[model samples]
Target: MTADLGHGVPEPATTAATGGRPEGHLGAAGPAPQVVLNLARPWGEADPLDLAGAALGAGLDGVTLADSPRLFPDCLLETGRILANTGARLAGPCVLSLGLRHPATVAGALGTLAAHHPGRLLAVVGRGESSVRNEGLAVPSLRTHRESLDRLRELLDDRAPELRLLGAASGPRTIRATAARLGGVLVDVGADPAVLGKAVRLVRAERPEAEIWVFLRAVLTRTAAEADAAGRPVLGSCASRLVRAPDWYDLPAELLPRVEAVAAAHDYRRHGTPAARGGAGRSPETERLVRDRFLLTGDERRIAGQLAAVRGLGVDGVVLAGALTGVVERLNKLATAVRAGLAIDPAVRTGPAADPAAGPAVRHRPDRRGRNLSAESEE
Candidate 1:
């Protein structure tokens, strides 16, 4: 049966109780932002079922399947299989490029998945990195991406209102589009505190209620070397993006040329591999800088401090990605650190809690940008 898409669903409110805190302040009263595991690294190296089970065992709130078919398995099928086998919510296919599939086709698929998963599914679409470059396709312009999302939302609202649509954004324009039109913005750049803080403020100014999510590479290790090695690919990816769109992020002035060099030199064929050569490969210092600036690394205490700092920025949630080697162990360590971080928040108080299994609900309303607005559901 088709679900009514026009009815206003009462999505959970972005109150201080849930992770969505008020602008400019961390809301300790709410549960920690949901920690999602990105299974991009394990897509081909590990079985999807095993990864899903590991994610559930690690107590991750959800799992995101990367949508690079050439580099990984089919995300849709893998996600469906995982959803069938485990209770871990599916967070995304995080479409790497646009124009490959018609928006309606993507919308229909997501709507069907939402119908099956209900509140457990979140649809994250964006101009992803490696997949497009590998295909020799041009990244869709910001305007085209926004329009695609707008069309996708319309289709989903007409067919399945319960399915929430979010855009992956890094710059001012995409952030504005997400605040104005989509359900939320998944900030997909390095976890630089300044960049994150600025993005959150930008979205809030446009739409105070829009959900804000940040993605970061996380590893729990005793030494900086181990952490840097584990996070290099992700860090390099961030540097590549910075180089391609220098104005998109607020990176330090001195680092721009180096970052641009990395982009210019990045070899897409060796994507996500440790040996993947890039201009950033010029020196160990560049690698270390990218790792420190882009990732959450070090021991539990240090990682906890970093997570807390991000939460303090009023972020709604965080998506953690890591290397394929010992992926489950890393996820377990990160989850433990997240719990510790949440425990330390001053705003957290002992009280009757909301359903722990329930995922964030999103609803849309008309906004000034002539786009649809999405917020945490009060349900």
Candidate 2:
């Protein structure tokens, strides 16, 4: 079926002709020099302004505004203002897809955000049963999904801004559509490099210029014991998510049972036998699995190594998965390590900002490339 992803949305003309390495190909240039981090306020407890400030303090690249729009409506707009005030890059709705069915609503929301943040805004779209259920909406079918993307593209063109639309989609069809129509696709989960490679190829094939990015979870430990112990709860789930490769070594062995359980729960039993446990993000076992698979735990080297693996997998950058309480600190440590590895400048603070509520007064901070800083650094 021909889905009507937004019209006038420019499609990448040719992947081969595009001036970059293929997805999963981290060349001498190294992985894309962008990192995204999460800064969420706990349900009913997070202040968007506070979260934004912390991200700036830690010199984070991006601050993804989480749930509780009631607490911070037009969160992107507010975040853009904060980023402008501080010079921190921004990205989000990391879990928001409520307006996917209504292109007008999407346009209006994005229009407001662009008006406030202009080039600072990134329109991320996705679908999740949990998110849709929470919003009292029905989960959309794949066909509808394609249509939604089309509508979003149309809306984006109507908005008339230079900002990019970042799609948080990974399934094959969604990835293909994203490549064909949008500026970039945010691969937030999954661990199969081959799968990601294929997704990249699809995008590159249709639109070589389309940016391919991967979001990864990492946790480092000083020793195997700490890594194992800290990773115990989520080990199985993490292992299950990993599409095994000879070159990668961070997958844990202790969490096999949880992995099996998670695999079974997701109908991904082709990977291995089902464990005695059951389900995806439920139960203590499942919760642990989720933690292990989605978090990077260990020392700096270990963490950096895991990220390196991600780079080898053809990912452009990693959008950090972190908890609210320690996210800023984690981001700081991660940014430092990754920057050192990539040989990028280490000073990435959202500079000279005392507060988020203050009106934006942005300054131009160019990268070593002499180009304006890219929003890709914003998670």
lDDT by residue for model 1 (286-361), tens: 7667667677777878888887657565455667774433345666777888767645453432211122243232
lDDT per residue (tens digit) for residues 1-379 in model 2: 1212122323112233212222322222333445656543334444555555555455445556543342224545555555455444445555446433366776677777667654445456666433354355666765676567667777667674344566776555556555555656776544444444555555445444455566555544455454434433323434444433212323456645544555445321111112212444645554454554456666677556555445543334456554322334455576666555444222321112323353322322111111111221111
Error of 2 at 317 (Å): 4.0
The stretch of ten residues in a row with the least summed lDDT in candidate 2 is 365-374
Off by over 4 Å in 1: 1-29, 244-248, 279-281, 324-327, 343-379
Pairs with steric clashes in candidate 1: 11-377, 11-378, 12-377, 12-378, 12-379, 13-377, 13-378, 17-30, 28-347, 96-128
lDDT of 2 at 182: 61
Error of 1 at 323 (Å): 3.8
The TM-score measured for candidate 2 stands at: 0.62
